[model samples]
Target: MKVYDDKHIKNVVFVGAHNSGKTTLAETMLFEAGLINRRGTVENKNTVSDHHEIEHERGTSVFATPLHTEWRNYKINIIDTPGLDDYVGEIISSIRVADTIAVVVNAQNGVEVGTEIIWNYIDTYHKPTLFVVNQIDHMNASWEDSIKSIKSLVGNNMVLVQYPLKIDGAQCIIDVLKMKCYKFGKDGGKPEKLEIPEDQKELADHLHNELVEKAAENDEELMELYFDKGTLNENEMRQGIRAGMLNHDLFPVFCVSALMDMGSGRLMGFIDNVAPAAADLRPEQTVEGDILVRESNAPTALFVFKTLYQPSLGQITFFKVKSGEVNLNDKLVNSRNGETEVLNQLFIMDGKKREPVSKLEVGDIGATLKLKHTETNDTLHEEGKKITIKPIKYPQSRTRKAVNAVNQKDEEKLNDALRKIHSQDPTVEMEFSNELKQLIIGCQGELHLATIDWTLKNIYGVEAEFKEPKIAYRETIQRSSTANYRHKKQSGGAGQFGEVHMKIEPWYEGIPEPEGFNIRGKEEVDLPWGGKLVFYNCIVGGVIDARYLPSIKKGILEVMEEGPLTGSYIRDVRVMVYDGKMHSVDSNDISFKIAGAHAFKEAFLNAKPKLLEPIEELTVKVPEEMVGNVMTDLQSRRSVIQGIDSEDHFQILRCSVPQAELAGYSTNLRSLTQGKGTFVSAFSSFQAVPRNVQETLVSSN
Candidate 1:
């Protein structure tokens, strides 16, 4: 393999909805580029991408696969990403490093929910994108409807560069820019270029004018030239299109039947000639807000965008060269942890296969065998250089489940396996909640959790069960009350005796001193988990020794840690140790601690304790027709509607609902909206539960 400079490299990512033929298009591109002798189909499960066992079993892509091919003196690195919303992490990571994104659209279905979801990410990164209206060979495929849908759903910036030409019941692509028709053979390889037919020439001419105008709009000079000459030369048009694409002012749409390999060769040629190169992309901002540009002669730096744990290869780290070139045996420091690792071997990936490469130049994507401390989002640079790339921001886990190993003794094994999986894919969050006392696994959706389960059972030989996780409810007081308790044990020798008198009240930002109480000392402490605990030492004239005050506060904290109401943690409470009695011989730290605990428990019960449930702010986007149904469903879940916003034909509903009601909401929402709805939620605050619900929870606890 030959090392290519930055100008010769093209990083393109294929992203779209599930079953949109991204993998198929990628396979066709590889075959047409002569990288492979025969194109692999998704049904056979032999495509270059989607090689994982889970992907094969599910017949969908689960991980982003990197493959490369050479076309017309350009080395095109094609990143095939998963289309399901569950694996959006892959799409996001790939988009971060891609100079251009080819958003594949299903010609039959048009713009779908998944497409809209992924489009938001592309817009977030502000990447130059093109639409590939794929699967045009289907009998029901309507390019006109798909284009109309794209224009309505995405924006009006879409301009057609190619249109489908039906020849003897077979689909051919007529390129507007080249003014030629590419007709494929029975095997769909090496298309024959012919002049546009008379009937299609009129439509092609109109599309060509539109394309030229869209491209010229990006440059003042190009616009002037178009006005003067009423047209642009082939070279000038290509340059103008590249500028428009890089500026995101124009998104060209092309038609292709990836399954039949019709028009894919022309698409590859367009990508190679017109797509933006790495050098054309905007410089990446560093963690410290400094810009770093890709330069072949600059200091060597690579950003790890994805990590994989291959069964044979322990940890395979995929990275893009951000600055300079890197050769084998070069030692690089992990900017994240300052750990040094030698690049023992560098390899280019084709699906699951690895081909050795001596060096990788700037803007090129490659993988290295093992790094001690390097993982996803870590920046690897030359030793002594402190450079860190901006990390990829992954979406929060929308669903979670409490996982338990079938065999209790295998709990450790299951945890170890989960940790490995997390290291490979950080999108899955594994946490042990002390309050809930459950080992929870949080992921994008149910399919993501299911994939983890399959991996545990088949890959690691561990069987686990997933169940609804317990809600982390809290206990607090609504009113102030006073209670006293004396702990005395005079069995034999020195007796254990202590008495505590304390007043408990709800704490707020401007809480006033309790009536008939003097503030001796006040300390505000934030809890490790959340909320705050304000301790007021209102003891007068050493009624309770200052030394014993610490013991009393400690005891109060123990009760707060495990509330007396339902064993949940208590928060935002002020405790005043107004008065107490102590025996010199028996009233040690232990004695005061026990007395304080008893007194606090008694006062908490008498002060009108209330149960608080965690509430999450949810933002749901559904079609306008389904808003009523979704709102009704949310009302049943005890939701408080905040406000609504409209986006085109979609309605965005904002509400606050209890976390308990969110269980299985993802699946239910999908079913209710026929897979056209999407939502995101975040913890808002803890609110008092309804009286009936509180009673049920307390009784169950």
Candidate 2:
């Protein structure tokens, strides 16, 4: 392999919905570049991009695999990403470093819901992008519908570079930009370039003029040049298209049948000639508000975007050279922890294969093995430099399951495996809830969790099952009440006697002091579990010593930790120790604590108590036709619809629902909408449960 300069390197990522031929297209590109002798298919389970065993079992791409193709004078680095949104973590990490994105669409399905969902993320980054209408050779494929869908996605920015056509029972593509026709053979290898036929000349000419106008809209010089001459030359048009792509003002569409080896060569040629290079894209801003310029001699700075742990091998760390150049044995310090690491061996990754290289230039992506302390999203540079690249921000978990080890002896092992997995994929989070007494693992959805389960059984050799996680419910008083308790213990040495009288009431923000008592000392404590506890000391006559007040509050907290109605944490309650009796010799902290616990418990039962369950703010995006069915299912779960907004042909429905009612919401939503629905949810405020719901919960507790 040869080293390519910053201007000659292009980072293109393949992204789209499942079965859109993204993986196949990536395999085909590598073959066309002569990097591989033959192309592999997803059905054959030999595609370089989907080499993982888990992906083979699931029949889908689960990880973003990076490969390189040396085409002409350019080294095009392609990162093939999974089409399913379940592996969004992999997609996001790749997108953050990409200079251009290629969104593939299945011509049979047009633009799918999954495509629209992923496009939202791409649009936010504003990376130069193009659309690939693939599988056009299929008998059921519809180029017209695909064109309409592409136009809808980009609106007025859509520009047609090629359209699929069939001539004399063979496949052909009409290239409007060059006014040339490409005729493909039966085997679909290389195409024969010829002049446009007379019958289709009118349509070809019209689309060619449209392409020139759209390309010229981005650059003033191009616009002026186009007006001077009747049309722009080939090189001039390529320049304008590149300019339009960099500005995100135009998205060129291309057609290909990747499985048949048709049009992939042309696609690669266009990418080498027109796609934006890493240096041409905007410089990334560091965490310290510094810009990272792609200069080979500036400083040796590398950003670790991904980390993977292979059981057969050791840890593999993948990174992009942000600035400067790094050689085989250069020492770099991790900006996160100030630990020095030497690059022992560097290689440009092609799936699981590592091709060793002596040096990697700036703006180049490569991988290294066996770093001691470096992790994903960590910035490494020369010694004594403070530079950290902005880390990738992943979406919050959309599904949670209570995880348990099938073998009792493997409990600790399971915990360790989950933590390690979370390090590679940040979206997979793990937490131990003391209230629910269960270990919960959260991920993107059911399929995402399935991958985790597969990892545990195969890689870690631990058998684990996921169940529904229990909800963390809270208990609070609704009204004020007073109660008194006396703790008198006659043990040999001395008699312990302490009496406590306290008034308990619900606590709210900016709550006023009690009306009937004199407020002398007040301590407002904020509970760590999400509420407030206000303690009032109204001992006017000093009947109870001030020193024992802490013991009383501590006793109340013990009961608050496990609410009287349920084991859930108690919150937002005010307690007043107005008057009490104590013996000088017998009354101690223990005695007061006992009396305080008893009195608070009694007062809590006397007051009207209510149970509160967590509420989630959920946003479900689905087709408008299925809104009524989705709404009906939500109502059954006691969800309150906040609002509904429309986007294109989809509806965005926002609602608030109890966490207990959302045990299997992600799977249910997909089933209800025929796998065309997607949703994201976050923790909202805790609200009171209804009367019947509270009664059932209290009785069950």
Candidate 3:
């Protein structure tokens, strides 16, 4: 194996919807590069990128797999990303480091909801993008229709760089710029170029003319030259097209059948000549404060994007050096913690394999093993360098499931393993309910949780049972009421006697804050740190001791942890210890604790208490034909339609729906749209459940 120099590097990410042939295309690229002796299939569990046991068994990618190849003096670092929405976090990590994103679209399926998702992220980041239409050999595949869908989903500026030459329905592409036609034989045999078919010259000419027009539009000089001469030379046209692609003025589309290993060689030319190199694309880095640092001379600064926990190999954190050079055993300080650690060794990763390198230059992506303080999203820089790099913002995980160790003995191991996993992947989070005695694991979706389960057993040597997570609900008061409780126990030499007279009312709405409350005429009730908590002294003639006031307020706070209606904690309620009696000798924290518990129950029951459930803002992307069905489904789930927008033959619907109503929403939406629609959800705010539904929740809890 040979390592290409830094100047020839090209970092590209392969992304798309599940079953869109991203992994297959990655395998094909590796095979064409001669890095692999045989092609691996997803169904037979022998793919190069999907090497993990879990991914192989499931026949899908769960993590981003990085591979390297030398094509035309270029070191192409290919990152194969999972196409499923459940592992979207993995895709995000891959895209963050990529200089260019290649969105793989299925020929038969055209544009899917997931494809639109990847497209939106790519556009948001303003990264240079390419559209690769894969599986063209599939029956009923239409290249023209697929290109039309791509243009509609993307923009009309998308140009076909390669033309598919169909021979007996086995699709093979012709490099339009090269002016050569090729055909594929049986069972992944080597491709052979043939003379251009007589009937296809006009069709090829049409695509070629369109591409040339786009190339001319990219350069004013070239456009004027074309106007004067009526044509552009081959070299001038290629230069124009490359410039247009780098500026994002045009997205060059390529057609290929990865299963047959066709059109990959021609695709390499586009990658080497047209794809932007890191140095070409990376903006100059500068200090935020007094000092300034350029990419050419700045001390080494690497941003860790992804981390993996291998039981046998410890922790491996992958990073991209934004500036300077990182050498072996170099000491770097973590900006977040200000702790220095030795770099040890830098390794350029290829799938699960690593090739150790002496040093990594600026704009190079590599990984280091067994770093103590470094984690994902952390920045490693020179010592005393108080600088921070921006982190890639990943979409928050919306789906959650409760898990427990299947074998009682593995409970502690499961907890420790999950924590390790979370440390490795920030996208996976865990929530524990002490009262409910359940460990809820939050992920991208159901498949994500399933993959975690499989990994836990296969890789971590721990087994767990997973169930749907229960909604985290809260109880709050609706009406106002007053109650009093007396605690008088005479069991020992010193007795306890205390009483609490307090009123409970619903907290003032419209953003719960300190200034939202005014104690009418009381001057001492204004506290800055206290939110929605008001203490009033309404005693007529010192019925309660002023010295014991703080104790009474503390007792009220302790009782607020639980409401009468449910075990969930109460929030935004103002409690006033207006008047209470306390025995100076016996009344202490313990006595007040008992009185507080009783008084809270009475007041809470008197005041009508209700349950509140968390609501989430949802954005569903679906084909235009399924908009009505999705809207109807949203309404059925008690969702409030905030707005809707149509773009590129798809409708994006935004709404706020209760989290409880969205537990199985992914599955339901798939069924509703027949696997053509999906959505991303975000936490909005906690809102009160309807009075009629509160009973059902409370009883279930």
Candidate 4:
């Protein structure tokens, strides 16, 4: 291994839908570079990228694996990411360091829903992107249809650099930009370059002219040269394509059969020749909005993008040098917490293999051993520098469940494991809900939850169960009511007596105060749950001692904590202690508190109490034909259609549904659309539950 400068280092990320041959393409790329003796297949579960045991069992990638290949004099750092949306956190973290995005498309499936989902992120980042159509050797592969699909998704700027054709029962790719034909042997390696055949000359010329025009469009000089000579050479085309890619104005398409190793060598050659290297990318911004200098002369800084825990190794932290260089024993301070961390050892990682290196320059990805305080998304920089690299922002969780240990003794151990897991993958989060009295775990979907479950049992040896999460429903009054309570306690020494009269009303912002009562003192409080409480005192004559006023308010709040209707948190209520009586010696704070609580409870019950449940605003994207099916499913969950909009060939449905009905919506939607539907949801305002639903919930409670 050699330390390549930022100019020769290209950071590429592979993303696509499952079965799109992303892992296979990565394996082929490594083998083609002569970095690996033999290529591994996903079916055999021996691939370098999907090395995890869980991935082997599932036959899919579970983590983003970083590997390197040297083509010519360039070192390509490849991050092979998971195609399943469940592991999208892995994809996003990998993309943060990506200089170029290579979106692999399966020829059979074309543009899938998952591809569209991943495209949104790439588009948002405006990363230089290229498309690779894989599985060209398959029996049912259709290159033309795949091109159409690619054009539809990426628009007209997608130019075909190569197209596959069967030459006498063998696969031969016609390179339009180079104006040549590549014919491969039966073993599918090192294609023989030859002139275009006579029969295909006209078609190749037409496509070649198209590529020339596309390349010239980005540069005036090239455009002039194209008009004068009616063509541009391969080097000129490469230069124009590189410019277009850096600007994200053009996306070139290539075809490959990764399993058969037909076009991977050509793909790597193009990457080395045209893809933007780390130094060619725009300087990344820091958290403070200052651009970072991606050079060895700048302050040394490393962005910790991922943290993984292995039973054999305690923890492995993956990072990319954002600036300057790092040596084996360099001490860098974490910009997040100002804690100095020692880089004990550095290794260039290839799957589970570690290639020990003495130094890593800027833009090179590598791993290090445990740092007590360093976690994912943290920035470690020179001691005096305040540079913090901008971190990767992950999507919000789509599923939540109450997780509890089956064996009570493992409860603490379960929490420890979960916390460690959260440090490894930030998308797996845990929170304790005081209102529901449950420890809830949130993740992308059901598959993510299953992985958590498996890790608990397999890695931590802690058996756990995931149950339906309890909704944090709220209680409020619908109408005004009045009630009075008297507390009298008899004892041998003395007797306690207190009486209170209160008027309870539904509270709203900008509502007028009570019209009839002469208000003396007022106290308004913002409830921690969600609403406000307006407390007024009309005791002009001091019927009860002023000191007891605080006690009365406290009592009312106590009842509000556990509402009379369903014991949920009560919010948005107005309480007025208009009248009260007390005995100077017997009516202490305790007596007043009891009377106040009783009065508030009685009035709450009579004031037309209502139960409110959380509402989530969901935006679901599905194909046109599946809209009806999605609509039907939403109707069954009592979802209200807010609006619908169309984009491309899909329908975007904006819906409002109760969170209680959306326990396993992700899995259900995937099944309904055959993995062609995706959605995102956020918490909206709460609304009152239906009468029958409220009755059932109350009775169950």
Candidate 5:
């Protein structure tokens, strides 16, 4: 493998909805570049990009696969990303490292729900993009309708660079910019270039003029040149188009039938000659707020964008040379943790196969094996010169499930497998909820959790069961009350004698000291679990020794840890140990602890304890037609609608819903909207449960 300079490297990511032909397009491009002997279709489950076992079994991309093809003295690194929302982590990581995005649209469906979702990420990254209308040769393909939908769904900046033409029931592409016709044979390889047919010449000329104008508008000099000469040559047009794309002023559209390999070769040619290179992209800022330029002569720095576990090869770390060149045996320090790893071997990844390379240049993507501490989002730089790149921010998990190992002995294995999965895919989180006493796995959707389960059962040899996760509720006092308890027992040797009189009150911010009370010593401490605990020692004449106060507080904390109302943790409560009695020989730490715990529990019941349930802020996006039904369902779940915003054909509903009511909302929403709805939620605040619900919860407890 040969190393290419930054200027000759183009990092393009393929993004689209599921079954939109992104993987197929990538395979076709590789075949046209002579990198592959023949193109493999998704049906045969032999495509280079979707090479993962799970992907092959499901016939869909589950991971972001990196491959490269050489065209016109340029190396184009293609990052083929999954389209399902479940694997958005893969798409986001790919977009973070890509200079340009090629958003593939299905001709029959145009922009789909998945496409719209991915487009939001593309916009977030501010990546220059182009649209490819794929599968144009399908019997039910509608190029005109698809283009119209694209214009409406996307922006008006979309300009057609090529259009599909049919001659004798055979599909061909007419390149408007070059004013040439490419007619492919039945095999759809190595298209025959010829003059535009007489019938399509007029239409091609009009589109050619439109493309020229769109390109020229990006630069003053180009606009002047176009005005002076009434037209621009191919080279001049490409320069303008590249400038417009880099500035995000234009999104050129292309036509392709990836399944038939009809127009992919020309698309590859356009990318090689006109797409923006890594050097052309804006400089990235470092963690220290310094700009980092992409230059081979600069200090060596690499960003690990994705990590994967290969069955036989251990971990494969995918990274891009952000600055300078990295050669074999060069040791780099992980900027995140300061751990160093020597690059003994570097390889340019092509799907499952890797081609060994001695060096990787700046702006190039490659993978290294068995790095000690480097993981996704970590930066590798020169040991002495510490620098960190901005890490990619993934979306929070929207769905959760409680996972339990089938075999008690496999609990360790289950946790270890989950940790490994989280390391590779950070979007899937594993948390042990002390309040719920369940091991919960949170992910983007049902498919994501299902994949995790499958990986655990198949790869880790651990069978697990998944069910609705228990909600983490809280308990707190509603009013103030006082109680007295005495613990006295004579069991064989020394007797246990201790008495405690403590006042329990609900704690709040800006709470004043208790009125009509003589205060002695007050210490306020923040609980590790949340809320505050204010302990007051108002002992008169040392009725209880000062040393015993610590034991009393500890006992009170034990009761707080396991609330008297329910098993949930208590928060926002102040305990005042104003009066107590103790015997010198019998009132040990254990004795006072028991007395204090009993006293606090008695006062908690008298103070009107209440259950607090978690409330989450939900932002849901659904088709306009389904808004009424969705809102009704939310109302049934005890939700408070905040507001609604309309965009295109969709409505965005903002609501605050109780966490307990959202047990299986993901599955329900998908079913209600036929998988056209999506939502994201975050922790808002904890509110008291309703009276009826609280009664049921108390009874169940």
Candidate 6:
């Protein structure tokens, strides 16, 4: 491997829906470029990208892999990404370091849910994008309908660059601009010029004309020449098309059978000629964050988009050098952690293999073996130089489950494994609640969490069990009440006497208020009950001692924690010690504590206690075909649909759904749409459960 300067490097990412041949296309590209002697098939579990044991067993990609190659004097750094929704975090992380994205779609399936998702990612980053209609050799493949679907789902800027040439009952492509047809399976299809097939000439001309028109539309002079003469020179069209693609005004779609190695070389050539480099695709910023530098003359700064945990190599950090140069043994500071580390070696990574490099210049993707403190989303830069590039935003987790070590002895081991995986992936969130006695793990979907569980057991040697997480429930009062309690205990040597009168009631849910009502349009009374406990000296005649007030409040909190009904934590209640009596000699803090505890418990029992359950503001994004089915399903869970909005080609349905009812919503949503529908839910607020539902829960308990 060789390090290319910013001007000669191209970082490309392969992205698309699940089972869209992204991994196969990447393997084909690597093989055709001679990076790999023999092409590997994913079905055989021999591919370079999906090398994890879990991935091989599941026959899907779980992480992103980097593969490097040289094409026409250009260094192409390719990132093969996972297509499943659960593994989309890998796709996003890969896109962060890419200058261009190749969205591969299955010809038979046309556009899918993942197609729209990856396209949105490309759009978000404003990167140059290309479309490859893969699996053309499969039966029921429709190139025409796929193009229309791409155009409709994406925009009209999707132009056909080359039309497939069906010659001698074999699948191949005709270079429309080159005016030559190439047939496959003959002499191994060395890309020799041949007469254009009669059946493809008409489609080729129409597609070529459309491509030329779109290219011309991007340039005034080209548009003038095209309108006057009905055609433009090859060079003129080339320049125009390049500009259109860079400006995101056009995305050229090409057909290919990646399994047969057809159109792979042509696709690489198109990328080399049309794809923009890092300096050209992304606006460079000065180390001072002043002027945007189009050329690479500034200080060194690289963004760490991903962190890979290799069993033998330890932690490998992957980053794209945005500006200047980074050399072996160079000391770089992590801007995020403010820790400095010396790079002992630099390598261009290919799956599990590494090609050592002397230095990685600007616009190149490189790796460093294990940094002290730097992790994903961290910036590595020269000391005293600050450069902050925007980090990619990942979608919120869609699935959550409680995890526990299969054996209590493996508890610490489970936590250790979780931390490592979480550090590598920003989308997987791991939390623990001492109250629930469960370790909560949230991820993109059920498959994602399951994959993590498998990895924890296999790679890290820790077995774990998973279950639906328990919602954090709380108890509060609904009405106001008052009670008085007196504690009198006499012994042979000493005596204890104390009395407390307090009121208990509901306050504003979020705001602290008085027991009965919150006074408005008036300044808050300087009552002693402001901070958790108030002792109103309405005892003007020295009824109770002001010295023992703190003890009473402390005792009140102790009783509040142990609610009378279900032993759940209580909130939104105010206690006021209006009046009390205490024996001067025996009424110490202990005596006051006992009196307060009994008084608060009496008042709470008299008040109307109710259970509060958490609700989430759920926004479901699904295709229009599943909207009705999803709506009806949500209704059964006691969800209230707030409204509906449009999200590009999908529907965004918003509703307030209870957390209890959404225990397995992720799995259910997938079943409803046959793995096409997905959603995100966030904590909205706590709402009281219906009486009937509460009765059922209470009885079951």
Query: Which 10 successive residues of model 5 have the least lDDT summed?
Result: 514-523
Task: Give the winner by TM-score: 3 or 6.
Answer: 6
Per-prediction TM-score: 0.96, 0.95, 0.89, 0.95, 0.97, 0.92
- Span of 10 residues, lowest total lDDT, candidate 3: 521-530
Q: Model 5: per-residue lDDT, tens digit, 47-108?
A: 88988889988889999999999998999999999999889999999999999999999999
What is the clash count of model 2?
0
Better of 1 and 5 by lDDT: 5
Tens-digit lDDT string for candidate 4 (1-701): 68899999999999999899999999999999998998898889898888988899889888999999999999999999999888889988988889999999999989887888898889888899999999998998988899999998999899988999889988899988777899988789889999988998999988888888888998889989999998888999998888888888889999999988999999999999899998888878898888998899899999999999989988899999999999999999999999999989899989998899999999889999888899999999998888999878888888899999999999999999999899889999899998888999999988889989888998899999899998889999999999999999998777888899999999989998888888888889999989988999887688888888888899999998988777899999998888878997788988999999999999999999999999999999999999999999998999999999999889999999999999899899999998778888998988999999999999988
Higher-ranked by lDDT: 4 or 5: 4
Q: Residue-wise lDDT of candidate 1 within 1-701, one digit each (tens)? A: 98999888999999999989999999999988999998788889888887888889989999999999999999999999998988888889999999899999999999988998888889888899999999887888888899998897667789999988778865678999999998877667678888998899899999999888988898899999999999997778888889988887789999998888888888888889999988888778788777786787788999999999877888899999999899999999988788898999999998999999999999999999878788899999987767898899998888899999999999999999999888777889899988888999889888889889998999888999999999888889999999999999987898888899999889987877677878889988898767788888888877678888888889988998888768899988898889988887887888889999999999999999998999999999999999999999999999999999999889999999999999999989998998889889999999999999999988887
Q: lDDT (CA) for every model shown?
A: 0.90, 0.91, 0.78, 0.91, 0.90, 0.80
- In model 6, which residue pairs have backbone atoms overlapping below 3 Å? 528-534, 529-534
168: Cα error in model 6, Å = 2.0
Evaluated at residue 554, the lDDT of candidate 2 is 95
TM-score of 1: 0.96
The parts of candidate 5 lying over 4 Å away from their true place are 646-650, 673-676
Which prediction has the highest TM-score against the true structure?
5
lDDT for 640 (candidate 1): 93
Which sections of candidate 3 miss by over 4 Å?
1-6, 166-172, 183-195, 282-297, 384-387, 406-412, 432-439, 502-531, 571-585, 617-622, 642-656, 674-688, 698-701
Model 2, 272-291: lDDT tens digits are 99888988887778899989
- Residue 283, candidate 3: C-alpha displacement in angstroms: 1.6
Model 3 TM-score relative to the real fold:
0.89
Greater-lDDT candidate between 2 and 5: 2
- The 10-residue segment with the lowest total lDDT in model 4: 537-546
Selected candidate, larger TM-score, 1 vs 6: 1
Model 5: residue 182 alpha-carbon error in angstroms: 1.7
